[model samples]
Target: MELDDDSANGLLRSFGRQVQALRIRRGMSKAELGAELSYSQSQIGSIEIGRRVMQSDAIDRADAVLDAGGVLIAMKEQVERAGFPKFFRDARRYEAKAVELHVYATQAVPGLLQTADYMQGVIRMERPQPPAHVMEQHITSRLERQKLFDRDPAVSMSFVVEENLLRRTFGNLDMMREQWERLLELGRRHHIELQVMPTACAEHAGMDGPFTLMETDQGQRIAYVEVQRVSRLHTDRKHVRELELKYGIIRAQALSPSASL
Candidate 1:
């Protein structure tokens, strides 16, 4: 499962090169390193070949075992930051800095609001299924993004989801029930406003698609729109203003926060 072009300067490949070089300098076989880190030899080999994402604790343990002087630990941030796809990187950065978020979801639950089981089910349904390890990396990365909800100065957020999404079963009955319960829990948060847009609603403004509008700490506003595999972050004032207006309308048409639950 090793990547063919490890010489390319991507973060994962670069990290793999560092790990391989350090392991060699220490005269440790992959099996020995895996034993020290309590991982399988194949796991260590995959990480060393840029085919697997290294968990933070694993990187820390590797740093110690290889006597890397914090080099691997320092690279952990970059590795985590690069966990998301290239198209999502800009939006991820903006979202991390946002003080407020307005989101509209049509087809499925938004990533921020999805439970682990729900996320796995959604990812598993992709047209061309990904390898188990790659899927695990994506799930881990998404769950990490949800840490934003626990920030000291919590971000104020509002969401409008299509009613069909609530009825759709992802995972299984038990998982779907858990997801519904989680939605109710999130709706009760002081900084969060959750609304459901019933199919019966005649005046829906989100027919165009799913989008997010974010207000940064400095009060700068940006809009993110995604379809298929492509995404765009709109920074132009006019474009953002239009999305803001559309979101306002969508929220107005959605069921009240309490009623939606």
Candidate 2:
């Protein structure tokens, strides 16, 4: 489960303190711990300060290296979950298990497609902006989602993005070019389809707003919709079916993958 930001920050710092204490009790310096973990002293410093998120393997190594006796290991899942906003945690879980995902993105480029620079740019522009630690975690967690492409049974994915959204200069010219290059590279993948909804289109089916239709590994279909950071995963068959059909229409109306690229 995802905790509120304050709670998450508290937990992360608490965990960091525990790791720090264990290191000190072992009569070891951060450099020594990093050597054992094959991480740099700076990386160890970041983790110790709760400013960096670590992977499962790194946690295991840290657990063994710091002699924490599974204390740090036990906090693995919970610590990672804190990186995401509470409203989006459930959807993030299902998305990881998805066998098929179709995204209609109306705002910025969908998370799965965003370049790191583009992702950071959008996060920084958010209202009531997140603190530095939270912002780093946000980018890390979202980037972690891209690992879906590396899964054993890859998730077949498609996206229909607003053309105007692509035209927006999220950063300077170089960054924009990099983002477009990233998009073009992704569009070349066989299992993935990328389409653009041109502003010139007179007939549009996605006007109701952006939504994601996902089919899980078990063949269960679901729909995810979010607005203002409030996210919903609709598992009801009726609603999921409606979204599936709506997505078909949106794809039909959008420019083809080749044209989009």
Candidate 3:
């Protein structure tokens, strides 16, 4: 049977969720789990959420820890060349109808809030160094993606950003200031929410890195988790429930919305 984009995306999400469920069942902190597998914490988190491909060794370790009985073992090979980042393509499908979006970012400003120039600068900094024209194409694509926020009945969007991201100059001081201003402007929008997880938040989920929760029109929900150069989408019902619970705890621990600025 052929799968449409949505169907394919859903399948990937379900896989991601399953990985997360196993992680929790094993009661392993991301750091501890990554250490056991000789991967970074981000790598462990990414694998669990299906944002990054599972390394063979890591999968073996996970199986051992969770006593998976090879349930997750078979999936390792299938996701080795999963084509796209976990949530990258799937996010576009639901952005239009998303009733609510909760995002946490520790590295940089959220993509939707990024300007064309900022994106170009980022693209230029990639290790392989995309050609100027290619970089421009990426900039265009990213900026165009931001237009969804302009839709009527506007999607409810909230962002929790690490305080350190605010001080790092992404493009230039002017650009950085513009980014902050853009954030403030978006927060002023009736449908949007902006918060900051302060450096003094006593270590929370944001410390584990960044993730996103998106609610679709039919009320189905999913989590999108990202790591360096990769992303994952998780929609397994059981996994979604756990991440949602953790997200709630993190939200409560982070700085208040008004105080975040």
lDDT by residue (tens digit), candidate 2, 225-249:
9999888889999989898888999
User: Model 1 over residues 150-251: C-alpha lDDT tens digits?
Assistant: 888999999999999989998789999999999999999999999999999988888899999999999889999999868899999999999999999999
Between candidates 1 and 3, the TM-score winner: 1
- Candidate 3 ranges with C-alpha deviation above 4 Å: 1-87
Where does candidate 2 clash, by residue pair? none
Q: By TM-score, who's the top model here?
A: 2
Model 1: residues >4 Å from true position, as ranges?
Answer: 1-9, 17-46, 55-70
Q: lDDT of all predictions, in order shown?
A: 0.86, 0.86, 0.68
TM-score of 2: 0.89
Residue-wise lDDT of candidate 3 within 1-261, one digit each (tens)? 234435544554566677678778888778886777787887666555544555445666777877888876776543332422233655555554587888878887888888766766666677878555334434544665576688776778878788887787866888877787888888788777788777876767645678888898899898887776676778898987877787787778777777765
Point out the worst 10-residue segment of candidate 2 by lDDT. 1-10
